[model samples]
Target: MTIRTTHVGSLPRTQDVVDFIFARERGEAYDPDAFDAAMTGATAETVRRQVEAGIDIVSDGETSKISYATYVKDRYTGFAGDSPRNSPADLKMFPSFLERLKNDGGTPTYARPMCVGEVRSKGQGELEKDIANLKAGMEAQGVERGFMNAASPGVISLFLQNDFYPNREAYLAALADAMRDEYRTIVAAGLELQLDCPDLALSRHMLFTDLSDEEFVKVAGMHIEALNHALEGIDPARVRVHICWGNYEGPHVCDIDMDKVFSTLMGAHCRYVLFETSNPRHAHEWTVFRDRKAEIPDDKVLVPGVVDTTTNFVEHPELVAERIARFAGIVGAERVVAGSDCGFGTFAGFGAVDPEIAYAKLGALAEGARIASGRV
Candidate 1:
């Protein structure tokens, strides 16, 4: 039984790609043709790199996106105004550490656009370009198994505050309808659609800070409901959902426990769930899967992260094998896939891990999956 390897969407972007993305964010004029050519070259390089690193399942690396959630502002209507940035509660508690993080140039300046009008597809042509770039890259690499990421409705709602909708449900409904276009577009492109739904776990410490874990589950259920609506008619097997409690180097003391939201997350229409499993705070939570084994549908698969992305230290191949074996012990080796805790380069200019080091870590993931193939 061989363990398959994939990463959460997003690998490091080249300086030229980063410059073009930031230029669009700044509303500055640029040659659209030149940007497209640069992005295509960059994407092909990333795809070829992933294949060389021994990845089985691959992504476009989200080369065209500014950030996972905020990129929607460009494709959809209603996200035009500013939204105040709120630091995670745990981070705010340690003011000195927060200061140090900022001083270290950890914060990449980007806009958090708010929903001031109705949410609808604006016909921006970004999704189409994204699909073409990814397909071209995969074609060049002779890679057939691939996926592209789209922000889930819940996650979009979390970052882009809704000022137009009368209530949270209303806002979510609008987002679901609007984002449905992107969802279907990706699936229609003959590639798996990965829905980035960090709102499920990350919001507990960031967006819904006032609510207790129990209460937060109720709200996240609403988020999943909206996502399900957006996923209508799409095959569950063609989709994967990524959940994490914020992808940053910090004291994540207040992240909601997986036990509290595991059931709510399984309620999604997606068949595969990719989650953080090897982080310092969450490594012990593998027992959460063992404890709730009955709840996982047979058709569903688990992609547990065997590599931690925030730190620079590359995991030894043996340790990665041991971690994968732990999950296989609970759910069978056939049901598990190797993954990373989160995307190394989440935002265009904001990757904490060095680009070369990130690739080296992924290289370790491939080697480790090989090590776990039989022993599990």
Candidate 2:
């Protein structure tokens, strides 16, 4: 098959779903049954839109999630409602931006869930609902393959501060143990499982700015171990891993180079690696694959973001095709898949790109893949 087109999970939610989420976040009483119905409808609609845009592998738009990583708090036990608030070092460096966010009421103020007790999966029912919703959407659309995004143990640690654990290591181990059940369920449902693991690369600037390269790599290695452990008994072929240097537009000079951790990424047991490559910050880094193709396993596929998610600009189809062709030249067409740099709506109510433009970009991505396929 030629290079296929997909995107990082998450698409903009309709106004109704957004309101329901905000109501819950504000501690206002809301109807659980109503929320579930709304979520199911939204998931189905999102999937239909993805197929309409010609995406090969679609997701439920993570419509049921508040945020990609922190949504785990609701599905698992041991997390307290009162999560600590912290800012990325990059954001902290520019306090004016924070002030602007506050002024615009865009500075999300949800409590960060803390590890207040030992972690355990609430039940399979929570994830099963998602699986069922996604399956229903795929059935409705008559699509073949789809994926679901789950927060990695490491990303959970990065987003939700650990207060109860004796140390970070202890906290991460508990998270991995608890999240394994969810990981297994998705794959068992005959869907690809995409583990969102920004902690490996994004946390260096966002949360671990205080650590040195050696110390950060040590921590990152542990993070990968926890993910691998959760992925045990699951075929690597059925799983794909995504890494990014945080999804926001910021001065990413502090971000760690992919070279520093490429080996660690290649070490993941998963057979596919999806990463940010279209944005200006990491665009040039795609050459790393050409320079160091030896680091990538032959069995794995490389899904590079040829469409930028941070900006509103709808990349020209030719530009998108050009980007895909670059990677195809390096990794071979069969081993390449076109994707977005990061999620368009990384958070429920926090999308920077316009919803209409997001779909337009996806159209461009599909067109680009078609153009690249011809060339390859």
Candidate 3:
């Protein structure tokens, strides 16, 4: 069987698109028409490049988005004001690293929109535009299979603090209800829907660090419940859930262990599970399948990441093939889809990886998938 390959979501945005997004974010005057044109060109170009690199499933590269989850602040209503500095618990452990980063040109503080009122769909036009661009890009590249990534309710709540909601459950439910439009739109347009639920893993430290391990799982489980509610009518086969322990070049000592949340992740309603496996901190976790092989349902597809996104070092095709082969050996080849540990350009211009190197890695990933298909 052919081993399908895909990435977590965001790809490197063209310099033009990058500049436009940054300019707008900085409140600088930029031509809206030019930005729109650049987004269209970048989407088409990224899609074509993915096909050229031998990727089976492509994305719009998220060229129009500023960041993965924070972009929702622009599309939805009720997200007003900002909350406290909710820093990641892992980062707090490395005070020296934080100082070094601060000394070396600080990171951009992306908007953290709080839930000040009721959530509603004000960004449907933007989403429709994204859909149009994806369809156009697919036609231009002559590639049919594609997917669009949307933020999960849990993630939105994690990034965008909620001072308005009475409690966590109420906030998450509202976010799920608001994001349903985007999810349904992508699937209805005949593309797979990739729900980015970093909260399931990352939040264990980032936002829910105060809770015990068991308590955090229960909290994360609620997020999955809200996600299922959002995905009520969509076919699970057409949906993929991507969970990560925060996508960054951090110590990651605080990341929730994969086994700790394995059951919670599988409990997600999506049929396809996309997770990180290439990062050094979590690379060995792929063996979990061998240990808990029986728990994986027959209908589920394991899309383990074979490419690392947090570094510039390009991985060899053989290494990627070996990674995929390992998973295939435990499960079956037909049930695996090669993926990236996380997004290459998760937050628009804030990618840790170099843009050109990111594409090279994709090429390596595709080539690696081809190699594994033969061996598996």
Candidate 4:
């Protein structure tokens, strides 16, 4: 069986594309046709790069989004002013490191708007352009499989804080209701839908730092319920949930062990579960799946991150092969797809890995999957 290769959505955005996205986000005087042309061309180039890297399953590189979560501000109504950036608990322990990280040259500052009014879909036409661009890009490149990333309702609540909603449940429900349009639109357009849900584990360190592991699991389950409602009637086979513990290079001491949240996460109605496994903090957690193999339904696929996205180190194909083989040994080779730890570009200007190196890593992932297929 050939193991497929994919990634957790966002890839680096081109400078012009970045300029256009940020301008629109700021409500500045920008040309709508210019934005459309930029996105279309960028999506085409993004698909070509992924195809060149030999990725069997490719994404549009999320060219139209500002960030995985906060991009919702452009699609939905109710967001008004800037929201406070959450301090990840572990990062807070080291003031110097936190400050340095924030000042990193690769990081770009963008607004995180808060919900100030009732959440409603503005019926933004941006999603349509993104869908058309990706579909046309993939078809032109002769790629068979493609997926589009949508911000999870739960993650939106985490980033774009819920100030207007009376409680967390009401906030999530409203967010879910607004996001259902994007989710359905992508799926209806005949592409796989990847729900970016870093809120699953990242929240433990960011938003739910005050809660115990058990308490956080309960909260995560409620979030999953909202996500499920948004994904209603969509075939689980066409859906995947991408979860990570904050895609940053900080010392991840505050991350909840994957074991603590595995069951609750499995509750998501998605066909594929992609999470971090290549990063140092969570690399060894593949053993968690090995230990609880039976908990994963036979229909479920595990796409483990075989390449680390937070660093520039190019993982050797042999190393990537070994990592993929380990997961395939636990599950069947057909049930595993190699992927990156998180997005290479989680935001428009966020560049943890150099753009060239990110594609190289994807090339390694493809080669690794081929090697693992031989062994598994």
Candidate 5:
């Protein structure tokens, strides 16, 4: 495997690109072809810059999708005619949920429906197109071993309300089956699949807010079971699972502790674990790994977040290098890959950091990885 670092998903969006997409959607007279051409050009340039800056695995910067979860929702069926309505809760991670509710106050409630559809039947063509475009871009830049991010079944179930399913378990299973198609598509395309599973932790807030800590763990286990079933039969080596405490700058007062979720996360069928560890709130918890290293298998890789996404200030190269060195010291250098605390743009229309700063942070990440690799 190549020794390098990269983002989990979503780079900050340029103002021009954001304005273009939103304007075009609102009946503004923007040239559709020109907008697409500009997006493609921008994405290609972004990938090339990451590669030139010393990152080994480059994404198309998730330029096409708004947020990892909502982007996939648009292509799938079973969503209610209404869009997601934000609920008032300080426990949620993304700020857009609240912003949406504030702006469109009284929108209908949304839920995920029980999909009776065939697995991998729908979205096959779209998946193929995305992979083909990514492959072409990678080949042009001599970058190999590209990967793409997909929303986990658990996340889909969490975001989309389950109004149509007979019950919650049935609903989750159906979603798992539906998402299995996407997992297979990425694997068949020979691209590494990074399952963005923020819901693994976020669910604690939404589902079991009143439950005891132990009770929440019990509830979360069911979600892990559904995710494992969805991921069943997939080769673990090519699969990576990402989990976080909601990707937003908020008072994570009710966020579940990693100790409560580590066992469930270990049960996931992925060879690599991409986790948030760069932000101030969670960075100190790296000691959790040092204390519980025994729980992690040696064969599995750890991609810890070395860059904090909530801030615009680019991390010092030496600071980035130290974060990587800490993880490498604990779990062999070869098994450690640097990553961001979370996607710079977890939501489509919201971001705290500027796009230029986001790329600069990635540049610093790549530089730091080089420094750490040399030391190791």
Candidate 6:
């Protein structure tokens, strides 16, 4: 198998595309045909840029969706836009969590309904639409290797406040079963599928903040079980799973130790594990893998983030190369791929780094990978 370097999640969005989509959605005067043309053009450009920069695997830039998690509310049944609210205080990344608490008895207010839906099985029509778009984009760009990100069943349950489900277990299981169809569809399309699962760790801090550490682990274990259930029968080689603390700039106090989650994460039937390791907050922790490298089975690949996503400073190519070399040293170079800490654009309305700078960072990442590979 060819080992390559890439990003864990999103790239920055073009300003014109972002403004155009929001304005049209909000009923401002914007032409639909023009919007489509611009979006397609921008997406193609983004992919071409990444490829030119030397990324082995490419993505559609996720420009079509606002936030990775909330975007699904519209397509899945049982969700309606709720009030816009601040992220939870216990969530660990949002600095305004406490300030939002000062009002309404310390509960963060939401503008949307906090995802009031239950996921249902994906129909063939929806699957075809998603795959066709991806395939069309890939064909247009002449790129053969690409992956599409989908929300894991656990993440869906956590983000979408499913008040309708009798209990959390049932809600999560339903989501897992519902999303299985989507998973199968991606596999059937003969393209790589990436399960975007930041909630794996973020949930412990945000949703279960009141629970004891032990209690949080139990609940998190259940979420992992549900995720595994959803991944059933999918070819491990074709799938990759990504996990991270919430992708924002803040104190990551709730960051769960990778050791605690490693066993459960490795249980998922994915060949590649895309994880955060380059951010200043977590860079030192890469040593944890050095100690635990033996536990990683031979069948799996590790894509550690070599580029920090929260900052604008382009990582020095030598530094990026060094990070990649470190991981390759621990887990043979053939089994290591370089990646970014997290998505550049986790949410639609919020971005900590400039878009142009984000692209430059990715370019640096690809260059760094080349340097590392040459050294190996």
Ranking by TM-score: 1, 4, 3, 2, 6, 5
C-alpha RMSD (angstroms) for model 4: 1.1
lDDT of 2 by residue, 215-299 (tens): 8988899999989988989999999899998887666767788888898899898988999888888999988888999878999
Off by over 4 Å in 1: none
What lDDT, from 0 to 1, does candidate 6 have? 0.75
lDDT per residue as tens, model 5, 1-376: 2347877867665666667756653447988677776666766776677777667776766766656775555567655344344432462455776666447532322223333433233466656656766787788899877888888877776666566778768877887887888888888888898888877787677655677878877766887788889888999998888888877656666778887788888888888898888876788878888889999987788899999888888999999989998988898888888888888766645777777788889889988988888887
Candidate 3 per-residue lDDT, tens place, 1-376, comes to: 7999999889988778889998987789999898888888888888988888888889998889998888988888888777566667878899888677667643546677677888888967888888889889999878879999899998888888888879999998898889988999899999999999999998888777889999999998999999999999989999999999878787898988899899988888888999999999999999887799888888889999999998999999999999999889888999999999999888777778888899899999999999999988
Runs in model 3 lying further than 4 Å from the true structure: none
lDDT of 2 at 143: 94
Which wins on TM-score, candidate 2 or candidate 5?
2
lDDT tens per residue, model 1, 289-352: 9989999888778999888989999999999999988888888888898999999889997888
Off by over 4 Å in 5: 1-3, 15-39, 83-121
For candidate 3, give the lDDT of residue 80.
75
For model 2, the local distance difference test gives 0.88
Checking candidate 1 for backbone clashes, the offending pairs are none
Off by over 4 Å in 2: none
> Can you give the lDDT of residue 311 in candidate 4?
92
TM-score of each: 0.98, 0.97, 0.97, 0.98, 0.87, 0.88
Colliding residue pairs in candidate 3: none
**What CA root-mean-square deviation does each model show from the true structure?**
1.0, 1.4, 1.3, 1.1, 4.1, 3.8
Query: Model 1: which ten-residue window has the lowest total lDDT?
Result: 75-84
- Select the stronger candidate by lDDT from 4 and 5: 4
Error of 2 at 230 (Å): 0.6
Q: Which stretches of candidate 4 lie over 4 Å from their true place?
A: none
* Candidate 6 per-residue lDDT over residues 167-235, each given as its tens digit: 889888888887788778878888888998876787777676788767776777888789889888888
